[model samples]
Target: MDINNALKADPAPLGLAGFGLTTFLLSFVNAGILSGSAVNVVMPLAFAYGGFAQLLTGAFEMRRGNTFGFTAFTSYGSFWFFYAFLVIFNDLKIISIPGKALGIALILWGLFTLYMWSGTFRLNLALFLTFLFLWLAFIVLGFGSYYSIIELTRLGGIFGFLTAFFAVYTSFGIVNNSLKPGTIPLGPAILK
Candidate 1:
């Protein structure tokens, strides 16, 4: 699961898949982010899992030769890594500010991705709309007060489940050499 390793030797496609899967994993946390009252509640564990995974993945992403890979993985990784430090010690101030920060990030990422992908890919209207909803929803979710964003948080969690169950389970399984996802399998397995 070294994101920087570039397994297939094609970083763009593989890196994107990597980024997409990693992003998917974060959705569960994002769901938690949107549903839970404060970032502090989730920060303790989020830092280690999110931070270390990204740190390793980002390095491999760089090795994969993705210009977008390193920054995306590492920056997002660093966000969690530093936050882990703040969380373990009960520094609530950092948690207080991150919701808004994450919100802004969603807005920017959505905008950039929409504009970037809209014109390039032969994306169907349905696909385009899905992306639109996905990106805009988070951008708007960011607007919720950190304390009272249950519905919007639920929306984020829905996306998280979709992406996780559909998107990343296989890749992560490949990286880890285990089928710990239990009920969420991407396809029929050789074992079965």
Candidate 2:
């Protein structure tokens, strides 16, 4: 049988799954947000969070022809790799520049995701919209922190959590849709 035939309608390949899964894992290692600045502190946190898991996920997502999977998994996976090698890049000794930079990047990416969110309804729609607006809102919050709006960063973290929650919840759709054999409403990910 063709490999494609075995899947349940373009469900994320293991790689894509791994990418999102690994990203989810990293959030735990970092201490009290980006409030601290120490290689000893940050590097270990990154190493624990960043590893081959993301690479595996990205490579598989690429094989599955998931542009979002490819882009997200690969980019974030690389971020961890680079994050680990701060020895050369020196990601520390800075005042949370990465957060502000991440905000900028996320804002740009959110614009694209918003476009994706506009696609015809499908099993993936909810996941995508949840991901899009949450990140867009998250970016705004992150940037706000740079301007001393600490509440913004807190709010950003909430959106970020929303992003994570949906990512995890969306995984359930794979199981639910597969079980239902053909029915799962579309666009709920944004709301639920």
Candidate 3:
């Protein structure tokens, strides 16, 4: 059996699932649905699914010549790793980060996502909306963290959940479509 043939599987579903699951857990924490020790749960998922899995997916996307997926997945994968590091540091008292600093970091990510979101206008509707929600979520979350505003943070969490939901749908759709071509519609491409 040719080893190359083993790598031909679609990577989008895996990438989307990683992003969706991690985002869902983190959003729940942000939404205050899980308090106290519950926040601890996201650390592992962030590093494993969001970080490593997405990074692998990005590598696969690169192999397929999907620059958009490669860039987005790898970038977000790195983001998750860094985020996990921050949490670990703070949790362990190795380094205490100010809320404003965290806000700044989040805002910077939002800025990057804004540009990515613009690019998504060329993709399908599901992907476009996913990036849209994610971009808004980062902005809202950053501002809320900076100002210690609970309501805005909650709103951001809501947006995060929306982002996750869309990601999940897109992932599953891709999976179904791959299994049986055109079985799931991802909507028309906006740019083509």
List pairs with backbone clashes in candidate 2.
Answer: 15-57, 126-189
Q: What residue runs in model 1 are displaced by over 4 Å at the alpha carbon?
A: 1-41, 82-102, 112-137, 146-149, 170-192
Candidate 1 positional error at 67, Å: 2.2
State the lDDT of candidate 3 residue by residue for 1-192, as single tens digits: 885885788898998999999999999977778773665788899999999999999999999889999999999999999989988998999999898988888999999999998888878989988899999999999999899899888999999999999999999999998879988787776787
| Residue pairs in collision within model 1 | 3-57, 3-60, 3-61, 4-59, 4-60, 4-61, 5-60
Of the candidates shown, which would achieve the greatest lDDT relative to the real structure? 3
TM-score of 1: 0.50
TM-score of each candidate structure, all chains considered together: 0.50, 0.58, 0.95
- lDDT (tens digit, per residue) of candidate 2 on 1-192: 776665425444333344344444333322135443434453553444444555656666777787766665566566656646643254445433455565565566556556555541343565675556455554555466446465665565556555555665566566566778546454443233
Give the range of the ten consecutive residues with the poorest summed lDDT in model 1.
Answer: 183-192
lDDT of model 1 at residue 184?
35
Candidate 2 residue 45 Cα shift, in angstroms, is 7.1
The C-alpha lDDT values of all candidates are 0.50, 0.52, 0.90
